[model samples]
Target chain A: MHTLALIFPYAVAFTVPLLAASLGGLFSERSGVVNIGLEGLMVSGSFTCAVVASRMETVLGPGNPGALWMGLGAAVVVGALFSLLHAFASISLKANQVISGTAINMIAGSLTVFLARTMTGSGNVRIVLGFIPSDIPVLSGIPILGPLFFTKTYATTWLMAAVLAVAWFVIYKTPFGLRLRACGEHPQTADAAGINVYRMRYIAVVLSGALAGLAGGIILVTYSGEFNGNVAGLGFLALAALIFGQWKPLGILGATAFFGFAATIANVSQVIPQFSRIPGLLLKAFPYVVTLIALVLFSKSSQAPRASGEPFDQGKR
Target chain B: MSRFKNLFTALAAVVLGLLAGAVFMALSGSNPLAGFYYLFRGGLMNMERIGNTLASATTLVFTGLAVAFSFKTGLFNIGASGQMLMGGLTATAIGLSVQMPRMILLPLIVLAAAAAGALWAAIPGFLKAKFNVHEVVATIMMNWIAYWTVYYTIPAYFKGTFLETESRRIPALASFRVEWLTNIFRGSYINMGVFLALTAVIVIAIILEKTTLGFELKAVGFNRYAAEYAGIHVPKNIVLSMSISGILAGLAGATYYLGYAVNMQIGVVPSAGIDGIAVALLGANSPWGVLASSLFFGILHSGKGFMNAMTKVPPEIGDTIIAIIIYFAATGVLFTRLWERITRKWNKEA
Candidate 1:
């Protein structure tokens, strides 16, 4: 019981970013645009959040919680703006989606490092804004569930859960969801039925960028408290989770939980007596190895949107 | 002329990429002209610089070929980094443990690297062929496996005297830098790897252009269904192409770790692996084209340090500039489409 209580918070914390990023992937892939740029988008978002939060901390005073929120907002906006480059290259110019995504990664990787060097004299941007965990009074009073759910919980955890719920509802229960999925499965048919395939794809990609950016902000405030030029392949891990999830919202939650738990185990291995003796590199490599195995097992039945990587052309019969 | 349209499109992308970098430099309060001036001069000003550029380009040439060869067979070999690592590790292990004369040892090292790389790539290839797993995901996963493998193995088996993250330096006798080549290049690290790379180029060119096997691979690339209908073994060809691609990448690893750098560094897949993608794109997926474009990229890379020292532009800025160029260069399809659109509009107007 105590072990569960100890491990749950950190797992949830790790899961949030993967959840956000995978959800972002869902939005784009379901709208017929394959977005391998999620990692780059997250980098842009993380850098933006760190830069904004750091500056905001200096000006608005660290006492204000609004500074973190503002930083998150700026990250989302910048992420969306940066994604326009990918959108334009992949959609408007009809470049290979994979190549365009790779370009975004290269640009983001170098641009952020460049900016960090110029502005901060280093590749890292440390932030003053850190989230504090608070106990919800009534929930904290419960028996086993109390500590697991309420005590010493960051507000962002609840926010992420809420966002997850909202995302699921929007994707599964809404008319827009129907149209977005239609665009992915059959863009030509959707086009004939008066759905604007290109517009839907653009919106989906932009939303992906926004959410990925927000994930970056969440990661900075919750986990690292600093922004380096790289996100340490967390974006790619989210992508692995997306594949493991089979492109479904609830499945994504399950997959991210599994990965997050694996990641948590790696992070807390030193504290756990049983896991402490293992070499750290093997532990570090544990999640990725699991991802590969999971992919090999789960990817066979993955029902990816049919037209996901294709360029929409109305004249193509 | 029509067959050369891809070349023109790639050139246009290069020019536009350079222009965009210039704009970025101006916005960053640096002289773009001065930056480029030093960049070129740095790559070519002296024999030492020229040797270094060739040494650098040798890895790119092999990696670029690896990418281009796979591209010909309609596969994206993003696992070149992993393959390179495996190859390098194989050579490094053999170089360290085995005591042999230079004649037998070096050839043995290159062959071992190729075999290791081929085996490493064949796993993903086999998976892709059998399970229909996307190569990108599989290859990326292989990269991390290779990364962690190197990370663990290097420290455990061949830890350096001071650095925990790197292997011990290779003995001079086992290295590719022959005394004659060193003399010719005036103490530059120009090595036998360059000759090996050139031989690979000619051999691959022959294999791709003059062989029935190449014909079959090309058919598979054009359309797997059509090729299957024509009695070609699609899965076998896929595995074969990827293995050959991996062989090139492995040779690159041997050259890079055994020749250019004396020791193996842990926790990094070489940048040349990913850059190979852009190289293949800009080179129009041709063998000779890869060699040429790799040399050009080598110039940019070798010149970056000098450019940083001479100009106000920071090294990070130079890196950003290269990234921008890679971005543009890799999106050659965009330029092709733009060209098509322009031509259509011109025809309509005329």
Candidate 2:
């Protein structure tokens, strides 16, 4: 019981970025674009967030609360802008989406480190402040659930949870969501029905970019508090969550939470008695191994949007 | 001829990549011309630097070939990095523990590395063939698994006295770095690995172009259904193609760990694995083309640090340039149209 409370906040903190990124992936894959570049987009966002937060520190003074929010906003904008390169190659040039995404990953990985080195004399930008966890006013008074969920929670955790709820509502209940699904399912049919397939896809990819960037920002402002050139494959893990969740909002929420808990436990296991019995290697490899198994299990009945990786052609049958 | 056209496209991509790199340099407030000058000179101004360029190209040559080989069978072997780690680990273990003559020991190390890499990749191949899982995701998972395995195994079994992050330096007899080869390169890190890479290139070229297996793999790549209709076993071919691809990457690991550097580091996923994708792309997935592109990339990589020291340009500019080239290569169709327009206009003017 004590361990649960102690582990809860850390797990939620880890899950937020992944949830945001997986949700971002959900949007792109739902709209017929396979966004393998989420990792790169997140890195770009993280770099932008770190730079903005660190720069804001000088102007607004250290520990100014508003700086982090501003940083998250900048990350979103930069991520959207950077994703345009992928959008152009995959959508306009009709290049292979996987190849374009790989290029994006390489570009983001190297360019951010290159620029960061130039800016900070090292390829890392450390911010003076990060989001502090706080208890919800009345919610903290609840029983077991409150202690685990509300007593020590990050603002971003609630923000992401809210985003997930909204995503579910929008995806299932809205006209826009219906059209988006139609475009992904049958872009030609959508075009025949007078829906603009290209426009819908562009919007979806860009939204994914923005959300992925926000995920990067969330990582920075939460536990990380610094921008290293790499996000240590969290974006890829989020991608795995996207697969594990079967492209559903609630499904992703569960998947990310599972991964988050696994990661958090692996990280703190040496100090904790219960987890120490497991080999460190097994703990580290657990999430990835599980994801691979999940992939195999889900391959036959894959819920992947039919046209997710296909380049939409209006003339195609 | 199509060969001429392919060469032209690759050259055009290279130019565009350099221009993009220049744009980045200008954005960062550095002189692009000075950067390029120093970069090329840094790679070629001395004998040792030239040797270093070849040494750098060695691992890339193997990895690029690995990617190219898998690509020939319509498989994306992004797991080359993981395979390299497994191979490197195996080679390192053998190098440290074995007692034998250099000639016999080196071949054994290479064979072990190759087997390890092949086994690692065969799992993904088996899964892909059996269950229809995406190789990209499967290979990625394999990469992380290999990463953790190495992370734990090295420290537990073969820790250096000084650093937990790296294995002990490989003994001279087990290394690819022959004294004669080192002296020939004027004390650069160049080794017998260069000869191995070249020999592998020739051998792979023959296997790909001359063998019945090559025909089957290419047939599957072009149209798997058609190949199956013609009595080829698609799953078996897929597995075989991936295993062969893994062999090259494993050899790359042996060269990288046992040849390029004396010791293996624990945490790093080799950038050469990713760079191999770039090499294969620019080379048009041809073995000879991979050799050419890897060499060019080697120059850029070897020159990058010197350029950084000589000018304000960061070493990452080389990687940025390679990435830009890949992006351009991915958009090859766009370039072909643009090129066609320019040529048509020139013909009209003529």
Candidate 3:
């Protein structure tokens, strides 16, 4: 129980960013677009958030939360704008989605660093402050669950949870969500039904970009506290989580949590004496190896959107 | 006419990329003309600099061939970085451990690297062939697996005396840098890898153009179902194409770690693998085209540092230019449409 409490906060910290990004992926893939540029999107967001927050800190003074909020807002906006490139190439220009996504990654990676070098000679931006963790007043009074879920938690965790809930409701319950899924499953049928397939996919892809940007912002304010031009491949991990979760909202949550826990255990094993018996290498490589096995297991029953990677052509039968 | 069109498209993409880079430079308050002046001059000003550019091109040539070869069979081999790492690791292990004559040892190292890379890539090929999995995702998974594997293997068995991040340097005897070649290039890192890359270019060209296997592979790439119906073994060819691609990438790793760099470093997924995609696209996925495109990229890469030192432009501008070119290449269809519209306008005017 003691150790569980000790690691729970860290686990949640890891899970929130992944959950946010995976949910973003869910929106894009469900809209009939395969977005392999999630990693690049996250990098752009992180870079935007870092630059905005660091600049705001000098004016607002250190420890002000307002700067972080402003940074998060900027990240979301930039992320949405950046994704338009992918949308244009894949949607309008009819380019290969995977290749376009790869180009997106390369552009984000190089351009951000290039700009950073011009702004700050070092090409790295570190903020003066991040969100401080505090126990929830009312929730902390609970017995077992409080310590695991509420105590010593960053406010961003609850914010992400709320976002997850809203995503679930919007995707599963709304008429718009049905149109989006229909576009992915059978765009021709959806077009005949007057669903405006292109518009739905555009909206979905943009929303995903915004959410992924928010995920990057959350990483900046919560745990990462810096932007180093790359997100350590967390975006790719989120893509894996989306696949592992079978593209459902709740499934994404479960899969991200699993990866988050595994990552936390690997990270903290060196500090804890009980975990010292396991080889550090094994612990470090555990999640990736498990993801591979999961891929093999799930490949046969994949729930991927049928028309996800295909460009819609009205002239085709 | 189609070949000429491909050449024109590639040239246009390069022009667009450079213009985008200039826009970035102007935004950064640097003189784009001056930056480019220094950039080209840096790559060609002296014998040593030219040698460095060629040395850089050697690695790009092999990786470019790797990507182009796989594209011939309709597979996107994004795992070239992982394959390169495995190959480099194999060569590094042998270089560090073995005591042998240079003639015999170099061949052994090259062969070992090739085999290691081939095995690494074959797993993804197998998965794609057997499980009906998408090669893109599978290759990505393989890349991370290889990353973690290297992250583990390097520090555990091959750690340097002072730094845990890198391995011990290869001895001169095991290195691809020979005395006469070093003297000819005025003590630059130019090595026998250039010859190996040239030889690979010729060999791959022959395999792709002159052999029945090449015909089968291209047929499979054109249309898998049609090729299968025509009695070609699509699955076998897919694996074979990937394996051959892996062999090229592995040889690239050998050239890089054994020839250019002295030691292996952990935690970096080589950018050369991703850059190979750009090379292949620019080269039109042809062997000779790959060689030409790689040399251009080589100049951009090797000149970047010198350009940074000489001007206000940041070194990352070179990488940004490469990336923009890739984005433009991915949208090559847009250019084709624009070209048709312009041609129609010209005809109307005439």
lDDT of candidates 1 onward, in order: 0.85, 0.91, 0.89
The candidate scoring highest on TM-score is 2
lDDT per residue, candidate 2, B224-311, as tens digits? 8999999999999999988988999999999999999989989999999999999999999999999999999999999999999999
Quote the positional error of residue B279 for candidate 1 in Å. 0.7
User: Model 1 residue B227 lDDT?
Assistant: 96
Pull out the clashing pairs in model 3.
none
DockQ winner: 2
Estimate, for each residue in B19-127, the C-alpha lDDT of model 1 and write its tens digit. Answer: 7767766766789899789888988898888888899889989999998998898888888999999999999999888999988999999999999889888888887
Question: Which scores better on DockQ, 1 or 3?
Answer: 3
Across A187-276, the per-residue lDDT of candidate 2 in tens digits comes to: 888999999988898988898999999999999999999888989998888888998999999999999999999999999999899999
Candidate 3 error regions (>4 Å): B342-350
Rank all candidate structures by their lDDT, best first, as comma-separated numbers.
Answer: 2, 3, 1
- Rank candidates, DockQ, best first: 2, 3, 1
Better of 2 and 3 by lDDT: 2
lDDT of 2: 0.91
Error of model 3, residue B344, in angstroms: 5.6
Model 2 CA deviation exceeding 4 Å by range? B342-350
Instruction: List model 1 lDDT by residue over A1-317, tens digit each.
Output: 67778898888888988899899988988988888888999999999999988898998887247888888889889889888888877777667788788778878887887778667777799887578777899989999988888887877788878988998999889989999999999999999999988888899999999989988888988888999877877787788778888889998999899988887887898998878999877887777777777767866676888898888988896
Tell me the TM-score of each prediction against the true structure.
0.95, 0.98, 0.97
lDDT of 3 by residue, B20-108 (tens): 99999999999999899888888878888898899989999999999999999988898888899889989999999999999999999
